[model samples]
Target chain A: MSTRLLRLLAPALLGTLMVTAWYGVHLWLDTEMRFLLPTPVQILGAFRDNGESLGRAALNTAEGALLGFGGAALVGFLFAVVLSLSSLVRASLYPYLMILQMTPIIIIAPILVLWVGAGLKSVAIITFLICFFPLVVNTTQGLISTDRNLVELFAMWRTGRWQQLVHLRIPSALPYFFTGLRIAATLAPIGALVGDYTAGNSDGNGGGLGFQAIIYSSQAKYPALFATAAVTCALGFIFTGAVVALSWLALHRWHDSYERADR
Target chain B: MAVPPIVELREVTKRFGDGPLVLDRLSLAAQPGEFISLIGPSGCGKSTLLRLIAGLSPVTAGTLRVDGVTPDAAAAELAFVFQEPTLLPWLTVGRNIELAPRLRGISAMDRAATRQRVLDLVRLGNRADAYPRQLSGGQKMRVSLARALALEPKILLLDEPFGALDEMTREHLNEELLAIHAEAKWTGFFVTHSVAEAVFLSTRIVVMAANPGRIHSVIAVDLPRERTNATRASRAYLDLVADVSQLLRSVESTAA
Candidate 1:
C-alpha cells in the first residue's frame, strides 16, 4: 500500500485488533471474574448510555490541555531564547530549570490544588509545567546548533544578530520544535488528567477524564470505566492528531523530518 | 600602468586559541578579475586563510586588506562560498539568493533584481521557487553561487565550493564558474585540494605547505582565456596539472 493509505489504515487496524483481543480475554476469563472485565459490547453500551457525560469530561480536559500547551509553548520558547542568548544566563539558570523539570509533578499537584484552589486553570498550570522543558531544551539546542559554515557565511555578509536569529536560527529550530511538540502532545493529556484527578470537582461535570476514571472505578460500573478509558485513548489520539496535523502544515514543505513522513 | 590590487595580505600570521600556528607570516595579493587558487593538504589551514580574507576569522598579526581597507570593513565587497552548498534548506532558491543582500539592508527592489539576474546567470531562473531539498548537488551549488553574486561583490572567496561534488559535476561547475567570473569580472580566491581543478580554473595556483601553512610555490596557469573541455584535453593543460601535482607531492612530503 502507499504510505498515505498505510498511515490512515494503521491506527484503525490496531484499534480493531485491540478491541478483538479485549473481547477474547473477556470470554476466556472465569464467569466469577467476568464481572470485573467488560466485553466490547458492554463497553459500547456504556458509551451509548453515558456519552454526554464522558464527552463533557473529555471536552473539559481537552480545553485545559490546549490552554496548557499554548502557555507552555510561549513560556518555553521565551525561556529558551533568553537562556540561549548568553552563556552566562544559560549556565546560571539551566540548573534551576532542570530541577523544576525533575521535581515530581504528582507530589506537587495536590499541593498546587491547595495553593491555587481547584479548576480548569489549575489543571492547565499543571499541564504547562509538564510540557515546558522539552520545548525549551530542543529549541535551545536548535538555536545554538546552526552549522558553523552558515554562521561564517552570515558573518561574512555582516548580517546583524537579529537577522541571524530570525532567518538562520528560527528556521533551524523548527524541526526540533516540532519533535518537542510531538513529545509534549503525549505528555499533555497525562498532565491534564493528573490535574483533574487532584483538583477538579469530584461530584460535578468539570472533573476531566482522570476524574471520570476515578468515579467510574469507585462506583464499580466496570463497563463505563472501560468505556471511559477507551474514550480517553480516543481523546489522546485526537489531541496528538491535532499536533501532528499542525506539524505537517508547519514543516511539510522543507524539513526532512516531515519530508520523510510525507513519503 | 598599474591598477591597485583588489586584495593584499602582508606578513599575515594566524594562530588559534593559544594553539599552534595555522598560517605564519604569509603574504599574497590578487589583482582585479584574477582567479587565484590555493591548494594544500588537509591540515594546511587553506580554509582558515579563506576565512581570514572573508573577515570571518581574524589574523593574529600583520595586515590583510581588500581594496586597501581592512577585511572587516571590506566585507560588503566580498562574498564567500563555503565548501558545503550552504543554502538554507528551508528557503526557496530565490529567497536564499535574496537573503544576504537583504541582511545587508539592500533595498527590496535591488535585491529582487539582483536575485533575478544571478539566478539567470546560474541558469536557475526557472527554479526560483524550488527549495534546497528539491535540488540536486550541482543545482544547490549554483544557488550558492547565485547567493554570492546577489551581493554584487567585487571579490569572491570560495573555500573548495565544488569539492563535495563528483568529478563530472565538479568539472561542469568549474567551467560555469569561470564563465560567470569572466562575465562578472570579480577577483576570485579559491581553496581546493584537487590540483587538476586548481590548474583548470585558476590564473594562478599557490601551493602551500602544512604545519605553519605558508606558500611553497606559485604556478601561473597558461591556458586559453576562455577554457573549454578542449583546454582540459589539450597537451599544455595536462602538463600544467601534472606540474602542480608534482609540486603538491613535494610539499606534502616535506610537511610529513
Candidate 2:
C-alpha cells in the first residue's frame, strides 16, 4: 500500500486491536464476577432484545445533551465577548465563572435537579452548568491573545471595534473555541446522565441511560446494565468526534493551524 | 510659499508615563511628495515621532498635523509600516493587503483591484494566497509594504520597515520603495539608523540625537533625482552619508 494509505490504516488497526484486547479481558472478568460483570456477547444480546426501549431512552438523553450544550455555547461565547470588550466585566464576573468551573458537578447536579424538577429540564440544567466554563475560558483567552501589532494595524486602518471583533478576534479564536466544544460535547452527555441518575423520578419519561443502569443493577440484570453503559460510552465518543469533525470542516479554511494539521 | 506642508511637527514632545522625556520640542516640516528620513541612535524617539504623526499616540505637548488636520482625522490618508512585517498571521497576503480598503467599506471589486495592484507593485502577486508564516522574511515585509500601499495613501510613515531584513533583501526593497514612491509621489517619512539607506532613498535626511531626543541637523541630498544601485557609489551619496555620520558622532560626544 502507498504511504498515505498505510498512515491512515495503521491507527485504525491499532485502535481495533486495543478494543478487542479489552473485550477479552472483560469476558474473563464476567466468568469470575457473575453479578458484577457481563460478557460483551451477553451485553450485545441484551441490547438487541431491548433495542426499542433503549433507543427511546437514548433519544431522551440526546435531547437533554443537545439542549444543554447549545445553551452553554451561546452563554459562554457572549460571556467571553463581554469579558474581552470591558475590563470591568472581566474583573467583576470572572472569579464567579472560575468558581462555577471548579465546583464538583456531582455535588451541583442534585441541587439543580431539586430546583428545576425531574426530566429534560433538570438534566439539561446540570449539563449546561458543567460544560459552560471551559468554552468561556478558552474563547476569552484566544480572543485576547491575538497579535498586538495586528491590533495596532487594525487601529491604523481605522477599523471600528465591532469590525475588529467580528473580522479578527472571532476568527482567531475558532481553534480554541472548538477545542472547548469537543470537551463539552463529551461532558454534556455524561453530565446529563449524572443528573438523570441523581434526580430521575423513576417515571418512564424521566429514566434515561443512567437511570436505566441503576434500575437494571438493582434488579441484578447484569448484561442489561452493561449494555446501557456501553451505549452511553459509545454516545460520548460519537458526540465528541462529531463536534471535532464539524469544527474542523467549518474552520479549516480560515485558520492555518487547522489546515496545517489536516494536511 | 503658497503650498501647505504635507506634514508638520511643531515643537512636539513625548514621554511615557512618569519616564524621562523621550522627544523634546521636535519641529520639522515635510514638503509635499518629499522623501524624508530620520536617522538617529536607538532610543532617540524617532519611532515615537512617527507614531505621533500616525496618530498611534498623542504628542505630550505642541502641535502635530498632517495636511493641517489632527493626526486622527488625517490618518485616513496615512499608512504606517512597522519594523516588523506585522502581517496578521491568520490572514493570507492578499487578505492582509486588502485590510485598509476593507476597513473603509470600499466595494468588493474595487478592494480586489487595489489588492492586486499593490501586490503587483511589491512583486508579491503570485503569493497572494500564502500565509505570513509560509513566506520568507523579505516576502513578509513585501506583504506589509503591499498592505501600506493598498490604501493608495498620501503619506507613508515607515518606522524602520526594512530593519529586520538581510542587506540584499533590504537593498531590493529599497529600490522597490523608490519605484512605488516615484509612481505615487506620496510624502514619505521613514525612520532608520542606516546612514547609507537614508542617503540613498531620502530627499532630505534629518539627523537626530538621543537623551531628550532632538533633531541635530537636516541635510538635503543633491544626488540625481533618479536613484539606482549605481547611486550608492556616487560621490554625492557618500558625502551625504559622511555628513549624517558626523552629526551622529557629535551627538554621541555631547551625550558623553
Candidate 3:
C-alpha cells in the first residue's frame, strides 16, 4: 500500500482486530462475570444512552485543561525568561523547581483543594502544576542554546541585552517552545482528570469525566465507565492534535522540522 | 595623510581566558576605503581578529582602534558578516536586514528605506517578504551581506562569509560584494582561505601563520579599482592569484 493509504488504514485495521478479540473474551466470560467486562457494543449503547451527561463532563474537563495549559504556557515562559537572565538565578531556583516536579500531583492535589476550596480553580491549579515543568525546562534550553554566531552578530551591533532577548533569543526558542507544548498537550487532559477526581465540583451540571468515572465505577456501571474512558482518550487526542496543528501553522513556513525531504 | 587610517592595530594581543595566544602582537592599519583580506591556515585566528575589530571580543593586551577610537566606542561605525548567514529564521529577509537598525531604535520609515536600499544593493530586491528558510544558500548569504550593509558602517568585517558556498556562488558574491564596497567606500576586512578569492576581493592580502597566529606577509594587489569577471580573466589578476597562493602555501608549510 502507499504510505498515505497505510497511515489511514493501519489504525482502523488494529481497532477491528481489537474489537474481535474483545468480543471473543466477552463470549468466554462466565454469565455472572459478563457485567464486569462489558463488550464494545455495550459501551457504545451506554454512550448513546448517556450522551448528554458525557458531553457536559467532557466540556467541563476541557475547560479546566485549557485554562491550566494556558497558565502553564504563560507562567512557564516568563519563568524561563527570568531564569535565562542569569546563572545565579537559575542555579538558586532550579533545584526548587525540580523538587516541585518530583512531588507527585496526587500528593499535592488534596492540599491544592484545601487551599483553593475545591472547584475548577483547584482542578486548573493541579493541571498547571503538572504541565509547568517541561515548558520551563525546554524554553530555558532553547533560550540558552541560541546560535552563538547570531549572538555575536547582535553584539557587533551593540544591541542591548533586552534587544538580544526580544529579537534573537525568543524567536530562536520558539521551536523548542512548541516542542514543550506538544508534550504538555498529551499531559493536560490527564492532569485535568486527576484534578477533577481529587478536587472537582461533584454537582451534576459541572462534574468532569473524572467525576463520571468515579460515579460509574462505584455504581457498578461498567459500560458507562468504559464510555467515560473512551471520551477521556478522545479528549487527550484532541489536545495533542490541536497542538500539532498549531505548531504546523506557526512553523511550517520557516522551521526545518516541517520541511519535506522529497521536495 | 588628509584622512587618517580608518582602522589601526598597535601590538594587539588576544588570548582567551589564560589560554594560548590566538593573535600575538598583530599590528596593521587600513585606509578609509581599502579592502584588506586576511588569509591563513585553520588556526590562524583570522575570524578572531575580525571579531576583535568588530568589538565582539576584547583584546587581552595591546591596542586596537576602529575609526580612530576603541572598537566598542566605534560600534555604530562597523558591521560584521559571519561565516554562516546567521539570519534569524523567524524573520523575513527585510526584517533580518532591518535587525540592527530596529535594535538601534531607528524609525520604521528610515528602516524601511535602509532595508530596501541594502536589498537592492545585494540584488534581493523582491525577496523582502520571504523567510530565510525559503532562500537558497547563495540567496541567504546575499541577505546576510545585505543585513550587514544595512548598517551603512564605515568599516565592514567579513569572516569568510562566502566560505560555505560553492565556488561559482562564491565568485558571484565576491563580485557583488566588491561592487557594493566600491559604492559604499567602507574599509573592508575580509577573512578567507581561497587565495584567488583573497586576490580578487582585496587591495592588500595579509597572509597569516598559525602557531600563535601572527602575520607572515602582506602583498599589495595593484589591480584596477573596478573589478569584474573580465578582471578575473586578466593576466595580472591570474599572476596575483598565483603569487598569493604561493605565499599562502609557504605560511601553511611554516605553520605545520
DockQ of 3: 0.84
TM-scores across all candidates?
0.93, 0.90, 0.96
Stretches of candidate 2 off by over 4 Å are A1-32, A201-206, A254-256, A259-263
lDDT of 2 at A13: 100
Error of 3 at A96 (Å): 1.4
Tell me, by TM-score, which candidate is best.
Answer: 3
Reported per model, the fraction of native interface contacts reproduced equals: 0.77, 0.57, 0.89
Could you tell which candidate, 1 or 3, scores higher by DockQ?
Answer: 3
Chain A of model 2, TM-score against the native? 0.87
Model 1 over residues A135-217: C-alpha lDDT tens digits? Answer: 89988898888888788778877878888888988888888887788888888887888888876764346478878878888
Tens-digit per-residue lDDT, B1-256, candidate 1: 2998899989999999999999988888889999999999888888999888888888999999898998889888998888788888888999999887777678999988888899999899999998899899999999998898888889999988888899999999999999998899999999998988999899999898999888888889978879988998899999998888888888889888
* lDDT (10s digit) by residue, model 3, range B1-256: 7888999999999999979999999999899999999989999999899988988889998899898899999988998888899998888899888878987889999999999999999888999999988899999999999998898899989988998999999999999999998898999999998999999999999999987999888999999988999998999999989888887888788777
Model 1 residue B172 distance off true place after TM-score fit, in angstroms: 1.5
What DockQ does model 2 achieve?
Answer: 0.51
Interface CA RMSD, all predictions: 0.9, 2.4, 0.9
DockQ of all models, two decimals each = 0.75, 0.51, 0.84
- lDDT for A25 in candidate 1 is 88
Which runs of model 1 end up more than 4 angstroms from their true locations?
A: A1-21, A24-33, A202-206, A260-263
What C-alpha lDDT do the candidate models reach, one value each?
A: 0.87, 0.85, 0.90
Q: Model 3's lDDT to the true fold?
A: 0.90
